[model samples]
Target: MKKYPFVYLACTAAVVGASLGATPASAGHMTHVVHAGQSIQKAVDAAESGDTVLITPGTYRESVTVTTPGLTLRGVGRGVVIEPAAAKAAGTCAAGGNGICVVGTKERKVEDVTLASLTVTGFTRSGVYATATDGLTVRHVTAVKNGVWGIAQEGSVRGVFRGNTARDNGDAGLFLANTISAEQGATDTGGTLVERNRLEGNRIGVTVRRLRNLTVTGNHLTGNCAGVFVVGDENKPRAGQVTVAENRIVRNNKSCPKTARLDALQGSGIVLTGTEDTLITQNVIRDNAGTSPLSGGIVLFKSFVGTASERNRISDNELSGNSPADLVDQETGKANTFEANTCQVSRPAGLC
Candidate 1:
């Protein structure tokens, strides 16, 4: 397997603040610098809106919670690490077993918070978890060996997850859902972007559940049980209107047993269930071979909850050496089109 270095997009502090709708550093914004052996939470607590908490290179054994809007938490170098706390804390985030939490309320979203250039590992639940936030950017971070998710968000909009590495997580490496607590209609993410990330050795690379208006592009995913899963169920405004394009997905043959809600999964490049108007195009999927029911290069599977997928387009993708045929459409839905694909063999014939 080829490894890709983390791509760093350099920006001035002023430029980053402006993009997040925060006060510029030149305009009396404070930067609270914390050295090794110092408490990052102390600096974060002292920081006001638009202030920045800059962490130096060291391992921090504490869970960090950021509720202040427009606050920036950044590490100076790649050696910054955050692991599980030594003792249990009273904070909601630490109690919930997450490394970092950016939280807000339903009526008031924490806006424009940034987390960059750090490694969060060995958390019981998630590495970075966020909810009720807007314009949140997470970049160049590494999350590994988390029990549940690597980087997860729910009930948020306008999120940008770029240039990150998530590996060996128990669940999806990057998970975005409308809400995990209830069954509801899909929510619009207002063009959230998941791009240029490396995800491997997880149950799934990326899982977008009950979300719309997002794009998963330019990602490299391999050695997971499944690569990308766009999931929906029987609900109003069913999940759709998302794009999966220009990704490299290969050799995801790790087997995972059947869960309560899903069957066994392996060798799935991109799987769509109970979605409509989704576009799966221009991806390179190769050498994924398995015998699971969901195994294929690009599969349109029957929804577990009996919701049909309709009007989705699968086109112009490059696929080779995938088992159970390259393209498998088990559902007989309306107006789904497959055209102009480069592949050898497809289930039910003529799709390739």
Candidate 2:
């Protein structure tokens, strides 16, 4: 708990605008600055499109839900934290009990939401959760000690998550699940970029579920149960095209409890559970645990008989000193090409 210079105002004239008048969307950009002892939710609720909410450095113990588009929540510093309230003490936030939850319904189409320069923690599910938005940007944020993911996005499109630090959580530091649904439809159909983030000491560093055109690059993932796990299920087989390049994915051998999800899937750097057309290139995949048959620097495996991790290209990766082996491909994987990699490979895997 670092002390920041805060404006100790009981009630300042900085209340959000009273009545909304018709203003040009291009010209009317307002900013509502809230101090400590004030309600940030009030500022967000009263804010119109293209308005900005600036919160001063302070600790706020409440769950925030913002639904408007083009609304930005900018904190003065990372010292501005939002912890869980007593009401949010439930086991999970998937049913709407999150620290900072931003949602846009399918019929509403809220776009251009941003959450930047803030620290959110101590929630039941995720520290920050966003879903079904047209374009969402979460930048320079910190999420720690949360129940599930540090940042979790589902059914969101055009998301840019960068320069974030997520650690010591119940699940992955960052989790993105962009799948088709009856309510959300096809989201993130274009693509999503996850770059230059730090993930450590979690169940999984980063996890993707049925996403299309996902680029995961320039990330440092270490000391997690699994560094990166991309999977598609039996129902949705086409999990999308993924490119994992230029990442320092190493030493993801964090031990989990016997009751953990994928408990045997530990000590692996990257696991392609069931995705199609994946290109893993130019990555430093080294020093992973490789405890299980599936654990290694990289693994291409399938969950079921019919479903397979297909059409993958694993090339030009530096690997060494793994417990089990450098690379592994289960019998269910099909048509995966492994070539031109610099590493000590397992049996049946020869360098090109």
Model 1, C-alpha of 126: deviation from truth (Å): 0.5
Model 1 clash pairs are none
Tell me the TM-score of each prediction against the true structure. Answer: 0.93, 0.86
lDDT of 1 by residue, 1-352 (tens): 6422222222236232322222234655676766677788878887788777777778999999999999889986468999987877768899999999999899999999999989999999999999999999999999999999999999999999999999999999999999999999999999999999999999999999999999999999999999999999889889999999999999999999999999998899999999999999999999888899999999998788988899999999999999988998888889989999999989979999
Top-scoring candidate (lDDT):
1
> For candidate 2, lDDT tens digit of each residue in 1-352?
6533333222212342333112223345666766766767778877777777778778987877888998888786687898876553432333455788888876775698989889998776799988888778888889998988899988877888888888888988999987423322122446688899999988889988777788899999998888988867555437748888999998888877544335465788888876788899999988897567568888877743346888889999988876677887774567788888888866455643
User: Considering every candidate listed, which one attains the maximal TM-score?
Assistant: 1
Off by over 4 Å in 1: 1-25
RMSD after Cα superposition, model 1: 7.1
For all the candidates, what are their Cα RMSDs to the real structure? 7.1, 6.5
Local distance difference test values of all predictions, in order = 0.90, 0.77
